[model samples]
Target: MTEALATLSRAYRMRVYPTRDQARLLAQLVGASRHVWNWSLAKRTSAYRERGERLNWVSLSREFTEYRRDPERPWLATLPREPFNQVLRDQERAFANFFAKRAAYPRFERRGGRASMRFTFDQRRQQVRDTGGRWATVDLPSLGSLKLRRTEALNGRLRSITLSRDSAGRWHGAITADGISRPAIHVPELDAVGLDAGLRDLLVIADGHGTRRVPAPKALASKQARLRRYQRQQSRQIAAQMRAQGLDPTKPCPKGVRLGSSNRRRKTQQQIGRLHAQVADLRRDALHQASAAVVREAQVIGIEDLAVKAMSRGMGRKAFRRSVADAALGELRRQLTYKAGWRGRTLVAVNRFYPSSKTCGACGAIHAALKLKERRWACPACGTEHDRDENAARNLRTEALRLIAASSPATPRSGESDARGEAAAAVGRTGPAGLSTSANREPTVAGSGAKADRRQRQSRPRKTRTDRVAVGSG
Candidate 1:
């Protein structure tokens, strides 16, 4: 096991920026690979329906090899043997993944765009040498020497290499290697921090160190506007071109222009695609950095598991939902999980039901009613004045610590159980289900109880008048 671990530890990925000629070769490889994949998929789907039996990679490879021997199947001649074999393997893996419920039914790969090819590292044939520059030189079969940017030093035995091109026409090499596994850090005993994720304030982190606000980048909004404008312009150009070609503008634009058409529309479309890519890159970079920082600093992090899908209701009216989606809270969580694993930090998810807002952090008192507009409130229980967001942050940290301490195997020290019990009690009181009954329990006139209740119910805002009447009658 240790020997296997040692072998695995040495592998790492090196992204190579290929030259123009190399980029063209990559495109050919991708196209060939996708063609093979689609052909195999069609064959397999037909066979599965007809024969009621599954085809393995070895059988498919053998079949393709025989098919390629026929001069009549001219397209088969264009397919590279290595990429063809890879496509068969990819298909088999896709089927396996489908059975495991990891993914949906595999789709046919399209040709002529972003072609990817894979090559295994053969120690005897391939040599990896440090160039003393930014990238290291790796010898590839037939393709010869390729320089890849070494983001990190290569560690273990190289297993396989996959070459892919992004939409931006950049080549990337993903190298899988074997090496020793680093020991994961055990959940540490340190101050817990609460993060309030929002659009305006990207993150409101509150801990013993005090509250700090991390605002969203102003550039993101600006870039989005530019992207939208460019996309609209591209659409207009395509429509104009269609009109010039005597084609219906309302219908889908024909692939490739008429024989004598200008290239203006095609160039405009490319410009729009580049702008879209730029915006995505900026957003992704910002998310990675922000998530990394959070994982590095906090021992235990607590964040609201907001149901973004549900929150997106009424999104048509306001563009706020779009901005929130761009914030990518889900992506933040994903990065934080892996980053925490790499750095040995703990990320605790607080329940969506947890009322960090309604509960007073200082006195542990639950407010009978707290609205979104009540940003500043004075806690009746402790006389502590609180800013809603900052208060929520504090409560999150407190709740997270309480949860961790309870879940720990070690017995609580003197007074620890008592403090935990009080925190738990408070949580039960302020939680969503717990507070639902509070509205019904509001004061009523003693003698005129029915009428008072009717008046109170009518005064309370309801989604419909029928609902108000139903509650009033009850």
Candidate 2:
């Protein structure tokens, strides 16, 4: 029987050039959206304060409609209903995230940051087509047809198109689409590997055959001097601009006094923004290339989940902030995760506290006194000399294989051959289940005894793909 394909959602972002009239309209839409968000938040907070009742999207939306009809607010009536409605939906999502503890309370969005407005309409009515020229246009609800620089053809079902203005004063559009491609099926034996990510060597990989190392691009480091020069110049320009307007440079801007924007200041700010964007682009490109290579080679891959947030804290010289920031470890892991999921592969992040470096892979002996600078060490138990990163990669592979073995229903019983054990390990490697450990043993799930769990696994039928465990350190 053929396997059913899983559909994935994808988004494409591109630079957009708007005419003078369209630019005005876009600005109006952004302003209207911000107003709607602020107004809805105020109403919700007031209701909660007075009646101890929370106002949901439906209530806020109803109030929004009522407010639009008021003669005092004629500008609200001029704004497109769809984008304005999207503002309410965005706020609702924000509140949901806050309540769920995924994010902090939704603050009112200020105008000067990145300005964006998402166009909303029924999918059946939306039209996105290429003009065969250098441009393409998408039909928005109230904005009509908007042209953009066409590079690739827009495929799949259109979900939404968002127009945004960056801090550098450039406008761009992003189109999100769904049901583009099917998830890939991975071959276990050829596609199972382990990774060790660090500053010295960006990634150390260990497949069944051997190991390979990928060096860090150090994009940020390369451009830091240039960026620092630009930043210093921008700071001087800001202070001078503030002084010209008779405002205190060190103190905050007065309550209602808005500073005038000069061409030179704007140009300087844009230069800084461009440089920042260049470094970001380079870093992102490098990560994508590295991640794509890893995913293409391995279906079941294990990596360390480093505590980047904690590591970035403090001002110590040994803290290695520049290395940590330049490494972009978190971003690398994030790319590997979603890409793996999209391709029907498994990407496991080992527990942060797992001492892959301290534990000897050959003898399973823990060396508590091993320091970071000691790149190589000799194990006392087995008299084996181990390269720090290489040993860690091998241990990660072994631990990952063990995890795969424990999760499999077909794990070899006592007296089983090593070859069959390896095959049994291969069978379970492509599943979502991941391995993590404090020592060498597998962490028990729930409260079931190991014997009872083994018996249960032997008795029960195989589960569907959706029922399988998610890829993460349990």
Candidate 3:
């Protein structure tokens, strides 16, 4: 499909500078939204537990509106209606996801968590106005046109605006738009590749070109000592402050602790938060660069559908396990999945239970006795020594090729036969016949509109910013 014709939903997030009063208003809106969510969740839980009745979004919203209007909670009326309504809609979505078995039960929003609120636009009443030259203003309900640091032309039809605050007290605006123009596609050199993710190596890729391993940065591991020290100091300060206030040091801080003025405890906590953010940023940067590199090189990318949560479970090799979790394997997979789609590439996920590690690549021998520590071993049947990760990567490639061949009947016979034989050999090494990899049974993760005022917007020449990247770098 052509770039303009193909429909796509995209989000652009930029740092927004709200005035002092506007910032206070935004904080109030976020607090009110959190209150509404928690109240709705409590109501839903009560109804389900008491009478086995279900409370849907609409009913909860209607009831909550009346509650807000009541004299008991007159302060709710001070908040904007749009953000409050959006909160209810989000709560409804949470409940729907829970019912569909995609997520756990909806939980109450905490006070000190990441604060955010989304506002839908009614073009007739309010919309984002571009005040010319890389500057635009979003007309929030209570807080008038908040200035956003725009770096690109907002061409598409605006859908919603989400305002969020990071842990470091910086506010950002994420604008969702539809029918954004996509760039032209680039044909890559390699047709297919298979990746095996692990703690030592973030990913091991086996492709037609060769095998490549991306080492994990271990960001959190590298900064753990510093983080622990800051955390310990923060705890000590908080306990001492609590005791100075005539409160028990061992017990929880008295209510309204956070409502107090700035102190050493708060500053220390901020330091710890900044460290955590730094680690997260490093990990994200590494994943994005690696995933983009892989996606740019291969058209058909195959990755194991790992149950990272299951892998992280248990107390075996705590440090190693923690490193695996910190590697953010699932996040990498998620990034690859979406990036592949955007770049017009195919991403195939191998079955999680598939023994990519245990099977032999050279002779297709199944090393049933292979332990986690056995990084290299000789295939008992074929007598070929193999590196465990390299073998798994090769097996993943073989299985992926077999899957592609089975799906596409017109593929070359020699290539198909090679993949089939290698795959069958790997399966045969496992046991007997009928033990083929379940490529066909890949688990499908239970995973818009708008035209424009014609050619006027498209006819405008694209602006190339010399000083900055695109607004939506992701």
Candidate 4:
């Protein structure tokens, strides 16, 4: 028998350049889509308010045909019908998310915010035309061909392509396709690593032997001065606009006043947008390099289930908050998740409150008195010295491997060999399905009797490839 390859959905974002005519048409499509989304939202809201009836996409889409044919809004018929219909579908999805309690209510989309349109047609036709060297074109219906910079070869079935304009005034296309790839299978006894995400160091990776620290980049530090200068110019320009209107500069822009945009103000905003894009690019570069390195080195990856949002609210220092934002821990974890799966590696997430820093890996004793300020501490029980970050990584690695060993059906039974027992003990665990306390114990989990303890272990959930145990304490 042969193993079958798995197919997964993937999206590739490519830089797109449109000609003068195409740009105008693309802009019109974006505006039309925005208007459709807003109008549909209003219609749905009014229907539910007046008649107490829910307006689904099917009825709304049907009414849209008549609305487009109406003389009052004939401009809606100028663009391709696909985007207007897609906007309604997108809203329907948003409503579904809201109903499922995954998102808030759908709101009207504003102009000049997120200009994008999707083309979801048949994939049997080659919508993507390769121009040979470093150039290609995306063939969207009615919009014509938009030039594309082909950085990599397009693969699989092209399902849909979304064209979007960024804040930097650049056009791009997000191509979603379905592709087949070989699944990753893990080998037994490979290296397992624990990762600690921190602002000081980008990542602290620990395996059985030692720890390695990857330094976090100071994101766009060099461009900060330029960014600040442009920001000041914008502020001064805004106040000058208010003063020109014979209104108090300190007060807000009045209800009907138009603080018209100047060439300088527009240019300043563009520069600011470019600077932000550069900073994001730099951050992604560092994250990708570090994550790729880790995925290549270790087979079993472990990390703490950090609550980044909660940490920020309680954080006192301004510098700490800024650093947390720049660290991009969430982005790094997302990359690790997909990349690890693609490479057939195992990922284990430790419970956030699992005292990785306070627990002594030497004797499995958690140092309850350990403080946040103490970068290094001596374990009171084992009398061993420990570096805070290093100890945390080591402890994380221990717990991760312990989970792997315990849940694994292949782990040697108690009667197998003395060598297997010693091996399990070396990693601070016992035989397969045995309680993880110093290796030689019979089952000291929380149960009083032997059968009760066995039942507890049996009922305990076994973790999958990316699953993390919710248990925090020893």
Which of the predicted structures, 1 or 4, would earn the higher lDDT when compared with the native? 4
Q: Give a tens-digit lDDT track for model 4, residues 261-331.
A: 78988988888778656655665688799889987777777765443344434223343334343235545
Off by over 4 Å in 2: 1-5, 183-474
Of the pair 1 and 3, which is ahead by TM-score? 3
**Highest-TM-score candidate:** 4
**Please, what are the lDDT tens digits per residue for candidate 3 over residues 347-444?**
55567567888888877777889987788888999888888888888887777666554454223245434443333223212111101222222322
Measured with C-alpha atoms, the lDDT of residue 35 in candidate 2 is: 84
lDDT-better candidate, 1 vs 2: 2
Against the reference, the lDDT scores of all candidates come to 0.62, 0.66, 0.67, 0.68
Q: Give RMSD (Å) of candidate 1 vs. truth.
A: 26.2
lDDT of 1 by residue, 422-456 (tens): 23222212211111111111101011112323443
* Residue 82 Cα positional deviation in candidate 3, in Å, after optimal superposition: 1.1
Q: What residue pairs are clashing in model 3?
A: none
Q: Which stretch of 10 consecutive residues in model 3 shows the poorest summed lDDT?
A: 465-474
Clashes, model 1: 14
Question: lDDT, candidate 1, residue 40?
Answer: 85
TM-score of each: 0.39, 0.43, 0.41, 0.44
